[model samples]
Target: MATNNLINDMIITKRALPLFRDTNGFIKNIDRSYDSYFGKSGAKIGASVNVRLPNDPVVGDGPVVSPQSIAERSVPLTVAYRKHVSLGFDTQERTLNVDDFSGRYIEPSVNNLTGSVADIAMTLALGAANMVRNVDGNGNTIAPTSETWLQAKAKLTKQHAPTADRFAVLDPDTDASTVSGLMGLFNPSAQIGQQTKTGAMEAPLLGVREWINDQTCLVTTTGSYDSAATATGSVTTLSNAGNAIPGQISSTAYPQNSVIATSALNGGINAGDVITIAGVNQVNRVTKRSYGTPMQFVVTQAVASGATSIVVSPALVGPAADGSQNQYQTVDALPVADAKITLVGKQGETIRRNLLFNKKAMTLVTVDLMEVNKGVVDCGMANLDGISMRTLTYYNGTDDTLGTRLDVLFGIGVLRPEWLCIVPDIVDAG
Candidate 1:
């Protein structure tokens, strides 16, 4: 694949990443505006939410005091690692028609790619805060119920998360339950039922608008999630400042199993931090083989003082991964260099990760445009809903063939970590 030389890349190319007409669900739900990130590497993305100041401590009677001036706290945001999707196709076969090229292939890919990116971003964010699971009067944990939604809402309420933008992303199982009258928000009688009579169910249960993210919803976890760090070691000490990713991130002293280590990036891991292990995924069902994906863990401890190796709670690995049983282990291994980590909070045990959060809890931060090119077919700057893409086609001189590719690039940045929480464990049809 050649680098996109927009200068040489010619016409018949469009910049926008077209999407499938039907699956615009995630696209319409997320708020994307380039007012901040455009033509830049990154920026300080945050907000000064309010003007109120902390209450002053009281003292015994004293002399007259002067007025004080204070500013609301400022929150900071950063772009996440860039993401992309690329494809190659026979140039002549697709020359049939541009719209045909887009509708048949590009649109569906773009739509799915967009949703997958959002889902991955949300997955990464789940580690930030895990919401409690709902249990019946019996001790058994139940699927997402009114109790689960309330618990998720409580997490944000304690953090002072704003009320207006609050939302809940329910998994399929829980979603079905809610729509089936479990939420206790609507009734078969009354005006609310009239909305259903017109063939639409009322949303915004418990003041949090609802969105279903089945395509990219979470279905990942481990057996022992609550155990504190079983083993601890100092892989490296994080230096406060550096121009690079910092030696602390790639320290050789770090052992292979899931153990405590220091975070050297500007955003280091903190207590209660639960992040996706780099290069890991949840257990795959098709093969009944977990390729060690969606590896997640809790941060039992973080040290900003003296030495700083985080205490990743729970024994991450055991005799299971060590060939004691001669079986391929899930989470192939512990996290590695630049494992994209998001503070998605935490959650109670569940197979599916249903979540409720404020809209401001997380964001897809855009950085540079990811485009593809070869010879003369040119496409330039184009974007949609805060996402940009480019495609190119040219002749393969050596193979005597022609080819084309399409791709997009962006990052995921969580603005407020505590504003979101995961409702773990909901059943999935797949």
Candidate 2:
């Protein structure tokens, strides 16, 4: 029997691209450059690609040229998420033209699939260590304002994030509230026009083009931990004291995403909780100067009750005594014995995460899923602008209907956590 040429998989994938791109606010803006390394065949889900980050530069005097070993670290981009949407077509529906069929089915399925992909990337915004707290310096809950964007931009700038291609993804409520707050009669005519026309901050506000995404993630509760806890005073490193040794900086220094033991953490820490340690101020990424503010961290692993250690991101590497490892250091000093630990939010409260970030800060890599045996089964596969989606059709003998499944395989990773800042909006607790 001749297969129905109208139900081609490649055709469906092509029809799906416009909806997919327009629907995902965060995914479309992220770094998809890693997709260039993969091809049409044999791309396994767990396979990884090493993403290279630029090394920090050093200053030199005029006398003689000094040689420095290249210091580089890579974040592995793995294709681990495989998400799909399935639908069935009866004899009557299959007879419709491709455009008609797409309007009925493809639009809704791609919209849903885009939300799932965006949700995965939205979680990275909550895990950001640098944040514009929901409260002001005086400690009152507040919606974001123009100053908030400036503060977030300042954080990104101090981290050496690229000044170009900045974007902001706001939760639905934040989008409305921020627009109301910034569109006062005294504001710029152009900004007011943008807000009045779009009903949201769609234009570049403080040099960041803002987008409203309903799929933004929320923090309904934080990790339960004692507010007055202290570090267990044990630094996990090889030879030096949480500092880098002369020749073995990467091996000797405390690494990011490593576990640190804490004392009086009777309630333990949650994976998304943000915390800070006393006297551990964040240093400027380029100049390595202390910002005089406590360095914040996002817990990456959950700790059970009575557990002693918590895993944190953006590792606690202090400046070495010799000053040679300043390029790799993140903190001004290691937590001293009994250093106070500070938790950001109360447990069981709700807050929506609104992300403000540079394009280079986050990445989304999609690989082409293996196509089905064309001679055996009808299938279609296509790649558009680095996003790969495939469709497969099979007959249900009992129901006398054909079913189609659309699938996308991809992964999400944070290239520079410091470049991403969260401007949280308070949500009333239930």
Candidate 3:
């Protein structure tokens, strides 16, 4: 009898084969170890798994795998299979398995770099304000308000008095008529005119008779000169020389024998100077003016039975004629500039871009002869699915006058969170 030809049949040896009870079960298990092997034929498998992995190997031919061994290998196996998956589930769940049977969870940690930016901004603002309050260079203790800082400026100027000196002349021998006539001659406006007699005869007329007496003398007086001279030959002068003259002129007009003295004037005080007057105690006033005129004056003169009015004089120097006469005034402190917040990155842009581009290729893959498989694909696609990450950055600049940094972040309202961390290239505590 002729048997049916069996062209494609052959005898095979017995060997252990990996198998699962159900198709879904096999697919899930194969996905967990995607980086290793799966299927009926020797081909790479593609599927996604949500898990963290170990640095070491999991499965091999030399060792019998235990439950503990499987537990330890679960991480690597999950990471390996984190990509290729069917579209039956949600996007997030598809790449990141979240079923009750899928053993994995997600946790978020603080990004210190982001938190640091916020801390720096707050600390800088406080420190700047404190610095402004403590500054005492010009003894101006009051910190300048926003109005003063923005709208006003320090200025210097000169001052003047209301009254000045005049001069007069004395001629002991001249008669009253002669003196009067001479005074008329010195008048600012005196003119000669024609004189007409009863006959209408006109002739050259002499101007108002003004002449210096035979003996002329000069005298200086602070008070107004009398127009009518009491002395027969004395002539009073009404104009001054216009030049500065320094000398002591004796005059019988002032009160004599009655003492005229200046009370001891207060001088510049040091950091520690204290005094008590009229039942009031005061610290030493900083001496702002030394020469020129007294900006302030305190009178201790005694009045009726020990009563006196302490005269207070507040004289502000007037605007100066030019820049040369400008004087500098002292102020205790001034407001300073604000600080800045910034961001930085550890890796270069090129490297980051490259990693992002090939994110899919970095994924895990598994192969098996029992089932069909595909090689490695995008790692991020396997792990993150539709989610993508974008890098952030920050930088700061300095402010000179206030020894602070420019606060660019808040100005733009970009920096909001309070807690932040920063990693700096340099640590300049000083």
> Where does model 2 exceed 4 Å of error?
1-7, 136-140, 185-190, 237-255, 323-325, 374-377
| Model 1: residue 43 alpha-carbon error in angstroms | 12
Q: For each candidate in the order shown, give its overall lDDT on alpha carbons.
A: 0.46, 0.72, 0.17
The local lDDT score (0 to 100) that residue 172 gets in candidate 3 is: 26
Which is the better candidate, 1 or 2, if ranked by lDDT? 2
RMSD to the true structure for each prediction, in A, is 14.9, 5.8, 45.7
lDDT of 1 by residue, 1-430 (tens): 3322222222222423445213544334544543254455322222111112223222223688744443232222233333444555664545545555556656666666667666655544543434566655754455666666776786566545677776666565666666555525545556456545543334655667755545566665333333222222222322111111111121111111234453443333444346554454433212224444354555533434333245442224322343331122223444555454444333333356666777665555454444434444554555455555555555677887655555444444444445667776545335
Q: What lDDT score is found at residue 340 in candidate 1?
A: 49
- Relative to the true structure, candidate 2 reaches a TM of 0.88
**Residue 369 in model 2: lDDT:** 75
TM-score of each: 0.58, 0.88, 0.12
Question: Lowest lDDT 10-mer window, candidate 3?
Answer: 8-17
Model 1 is weakest, by summed lDDT over 10 consecutive residues, at 239-248
lDDT of 2 by residue, 1-430 (tens): 4334465666788888767877777778888877877664758777766666678666666989888776676676667678899987766666568778888999999999998878767755555767776575766446778788788888888777888888988878888888788777355686578678888776565878656556545544665676677887766632212212111112212224545677757676666677888888989877778889888877765667677676676777777677554666788888887888887766544677788888888777778777787432468878788788888887776776688889888877677777778777777544
Best by lDDT: 2
